[model samples]
Structure formats: C-alpha cells, structure tokens
Target: MIGLVLAAGAGRRLRPHTDTLPKALVPVDGDLSVLDLTLRNFSEIGLTEAAVVVGYRKEAVYARKDELQAAYGLKLTLIDNDRAEEWNNAYSLWCARDVLKQGAVLANGDTVHPVSVERTLLDSRGGGRRIILALDTAKRLADEEMKVIAADGRGVRQITKLMDPAAATGEYIGVTLIEPEAAEALADALKATFERDPDLYYEDGYQELVDRGFRIDVAPIGDVPWVEIDNHDDLARGREIACLY
Candidate 1:
C-alpha cells in the first residue's frame, strides 16, 4: 500500500510560517519539518511510496519534494487540491480518492507522532476491518479535538468535533489505513460530506461510512504523546513530541 498525506490546509492560525510554506513544512526539531517526520515514519514501516495532497502553498512542497524523497528514500506523488484554501480537509482528502484505490496508510501532515502509531495500524491490518483509525484514548479531550464515541472501545459509533468532551472516548489522531475493499465507498462518502458542507472535517466522512454500516475499527495508542500542529502553541508541543519520535 502507498502512504497518503493530507497537507492541503492553510492553517490560518499558524500564520507567517504558513504564509510562505504549508503547515507540514514548519520546522519542529530544528530543521526537521512535520512532513519530514511523517515521511520518515512511513518509510520506517515499509510504505515506500507516498501521495501528498497539497494546497495553500503547493509550490513550496514541490521545491523540496526531491530533497525529501532522497532523504526518506521514498517516491512522492503530489496531489493538487484547488479548493484547499476555501474548503476544509474533507475535500482535501476526497482529492486523493483516485490514489487511495490502491490502498493507503493515510496520515495528516500536520500531526506529530512516532512510527509506532504507523506500526499499530499496519500490524492490525487484514482482519475484516476495511478502515482502521489510530486513536488516542489516553489523551484528555478538548472541544477542538476531533473526538470519537465508540461502542465498547472497538466499533466506532460516531466521529465528530461537536461531541461533548465528557462523553467522547478519545481523539482520532488523523492516521488511518484504507484497504482496497473500502476505497470506493470511502471516496463516495467523502464526496457526499463535502457536497453537504465544505467546512466538514474528513472525520465527517468516517461518520458517513459508519452510518452506512462499514466496520471501521479503532486501535488505541495508549499514553503515546502526539500533537496536531495548528497554532503557535501546538507547534511548541509538536517540537516536544518530535523529540520523542
């Protein structure tokens, strides 16, 4: 399976840095960028080919694509998202519908986590689960987090940002495995989600699939530190987490 990364968002909260470069290109550990760590993780787990959905500052990624590919020893395909600045990630992910048909271990470019998260999802593959999300059940929930409510912590009952923090089980860490069997259906769900509302998160697509009776499972990464870089505060936290990786 090829690796997939959604690096399209402008990350308005992270301005100046995101003014010229995408959030994925923001440096976390000195010169090492969020995209650098993501590609390294994918390579560590044998995902030698990766497709990155780029928008906001797409040219920035193109400028460094060759360097990143050489450093990670992986082939990179950049997918353009024309509506990236105007739309949310639900459409950004939908832009990758064609490449995802080959099966993919997809990760959000702005999230900082170790290769262990990638390993957990890869190891749990092929057991009747078409979609497997890397969840952090151990983290404290906040209103801004992409939360999930699972039935007995195995089957995902719901995934949304509007859920009450007290009632949610955990956060969906923006990493997922999409098997070939579920690719077409997932793409369709993503399309429906974006059509209904351009501001919807890709998690909305997961909810759509769950509503359609797809068996999407969760693999909880207990007590594992990870941070989704959105604003300046998160960038600091991401640096700390990057050291752990």
Candidate 2:
C-alpha cells in the first residue's frame, strides 16, 4: 500500500501563509511542515511511496517535491486537483483514484498526528475489512468536528459533520486505510458525492459508501495527541503537540 495525502484545499482562513503555499505546507515544527510530518509518519510505517493531491498554489509543492522526497526517503507522486479552489476534498480525493486502487493509508495533509494513528489503522487491517478509519473516541466533539456513529461489529453507520455531537461515537481523525478491493467503489462514491454537491467533504463520500451497504470499520486511536489544522488557533495547537510526536 502507498501513502495518500489530500492536500489540495486552499485554506482561506489561513490567509498570507496559504496565499503562496497550500495548508499542508504550513509549518508546525520549526522547519517541518504538516506535509513533512505526514511523510515522516508514512515512512516510519514502512510506506516508502506516497501520492499527494496538490492544488491551490500547487507550484509550491512542485518546488519542494525533490527536497521532501529526499528528506522522507520515499518516492513522491503529485496528483493535480484543478478544482481545489472551487470545490471540496471529495474531488481532491477522487483525483487520486488510480493511486487508491493500489490500496493506501490516507491522511489529510492538514492533520498533525503521531505515527501511532497510522499504526493503529494498519494494525486493524484484515478480517475482510476494506476501509478502516482512525476514530478518536477520547476527544470531546463539537458540531464543527466530523463525527461518527459506529457499533462494535456493525461498523460505521454514520459519518458527517452535521450530525448532533451528542449522538456521535467519535470523531474521524482524518486518517484511513483503504484496501485495494474497496478503491473502485470508493472512487465512484467520491465522484457521486462531489457531483451532487461540490461543497461536500470527502467524509460525505464515506457516508455514501455506508448508504450503499459498505462496512467501514473504525479503529479507535486511544487518547492520542493530534490536531487538524484549519485556522490559526488549530495551527497553534498543532505546534504545541507536533514536537511531542
């Protein structure tokens, strides 16, 4: 399996920092960007090749592609998402459909988490599971967070940000393991998700999968130190915890 990163979105809330670089390039540790951490985590987990979906100042990534590859000791494949500025991540993810077909450990480029999160997903693989998401059962959920409702054996029944926080079992920590068998269907689901509403998140695509009777397993990353960097506050929080990772 290869590592997949969805790093196409333009974080408008992040302004000047994102004006030239994508959100993934925003540094959390001294000189290590969020993407750097992601690649490092992938490397640590034995995934020596990765595909990154890039847009919204994609040139910045192109400029640093070789440097990032050399630093991470991995091969980098940059996928282009032309509509990143106009659409949501459902499309960004779909852009890497071919790569996903090979199976992948997918991490949102803006998330800063330790290698443990990836390890948890990897450890939970098999037993006929096609898709496994890293769910954080410990974090207190808010309406803004992408919430999930999953049962022990039944797997995830619902995954969305619009759901009531009180009803959610956990928050999806922006990491997933996709088995090769599930990729085609997932790609189709993602296509339908974005075509229906360009503003919908890739999580919505997972919802689509559930709606179609796909069993998406959830692996709880117990009490992990992680942050999804959205705005400046998240970036600050990321910095505090990134060093710990």
Candidate 3:
C-alpha cells in the first residue's frame, strides 16, 4: 500500500505561515514540517511511494517535492484539487481516487503523529476488514473533535463533529488504512458527499459508507502524543509533542 496525504486545505486559521505554504508545510520540528514527518513515518513503514493531494498554494509543494522525496527516499505523486479553496476535503480526497484504488495508509497532512499510529493500523489489517480508522480512545472528546460512536462488533456507527462528546466512543485521529476492496465504494461515497454539500468533510464520506452497510473498523491508538494542527495553539502543541515522536 502507498501513503496518501490530504494536504489541500488552505488552513486560514494559520496565518503568515500559510500565506504561501499549505498547512502540511508548516514547520513543527525546526525545519521538519508536518508533511516531512508524515513522509518519514510512511518511509519507516516500508511504503516506498506516496500520493499527496495538493491545492490552495500548491506551488509551494511542487517547489519542495524533489527535496521531500530525496529526504524520505520515496517517490511522490501529486493529485490536484482545483476546488480546494471553494470546497472541503471530501473533494480533495476524491481527487486521489485512483491512488486509493491501489490501497493506502492515509494521513491528514495537518496531523502530527508518531510512526506507531501507522504501525498500529498496519498491525490490525486483515480479518476481512476493508477500512480501519485510527481512533484515539484515550483523548478527552470535546466539541471540536471529530467524534466516533463504535461498538464491539458493530464497528463505527457514527462519525461527525456535531455529535455530543458524552456519547462518543473516541476521536478519529485522521489516520486510516484503506484496503483496495473499499476504495471504489469510498470514492463513490466521497463524490456523493461533496456533490450533495461541497462543505462536507471526508469523514462524512465514511458516514456514507456506514449508511450503505459497509463495515469500517476502528483501531485505537491508545495514549499517544499526537496533535491535529488547525490554529496557533494547535501548532504550539504540535511542536511540543512532535519532537517527542
């Protein structure tokens, strides 16, 4: 499986840093950006190839593509998302449909996590599961977290940001293992999600999958030091924990 990164968001919350570069390029560890850590994690997991969905100042990524490749020792394929500035990540993810068909370990470019999260997902592969999401059961769920509601055998029953924190099973940490068997359906679901409401998140596509009777399992990452950088505070937390990773 290849590594897939959804790095198309403009991240308006992140100012000057995102003026020219995408959130993925925002540095958390000195010169090492979030994308750098992601690529490094992928390379450590033996994924020799990676596809990045780029938009909203994508030229920044293009300029550093060769440098990132050489640093990670992996080939990179960039998927363009023309509507990144106008739409949500559901469409950005849809842009990489072909790459998803090849199976992939997808990580949100703004997330800073350790290689253990990827290893946890990889270790949980098989047993007829098509898609496995990295769920953080240890984190205290809040209104901003993308919460999940899952059961022992029922898998994920719901995933949304609007859900009450009291009822959530955990938070999806933005890492997922998409098996080839679920790719086509996932792509279709993503298409439907964005076409229905261009503002919907890709997690809504996962909800679409559940609505269609597809089983999506969850792999808890346990107590892990990870942060999804969305603002200055998040970036600060990312810097503090990313170095530990």
Q: Best lDDT goes to which candidate?
A: 3
Q: Model 1 lDDT vs. the true structure?
A: 0.91
Runs off by more than 4 Å, candidate 1: none
* Model 3 lDDT at residue 160: 99
1 or 2: which has the higher lDDT? 2
> In terms of TM-score, how similar is model 2 to the real structure?
0.99
lDDT against the true structure, per candidate, is 0.91, 0.94, 0.96
Give per-residue lDDT, candidate 1, residue 245.
Answer: 70
Per-residue lDDT tens digits of candidate 2, residues 25-129? Answer: 988999999999999999999988999999998999999999999999999999999999999999999999999889999999999999999999999998999
Model 1: how large is the Cα RMSD against the reference? 1.1
TM-scores of the models, in the order given:
0.97, 0.99, 0.99
Model 1 misses residue 238 by how many Å? 0.8
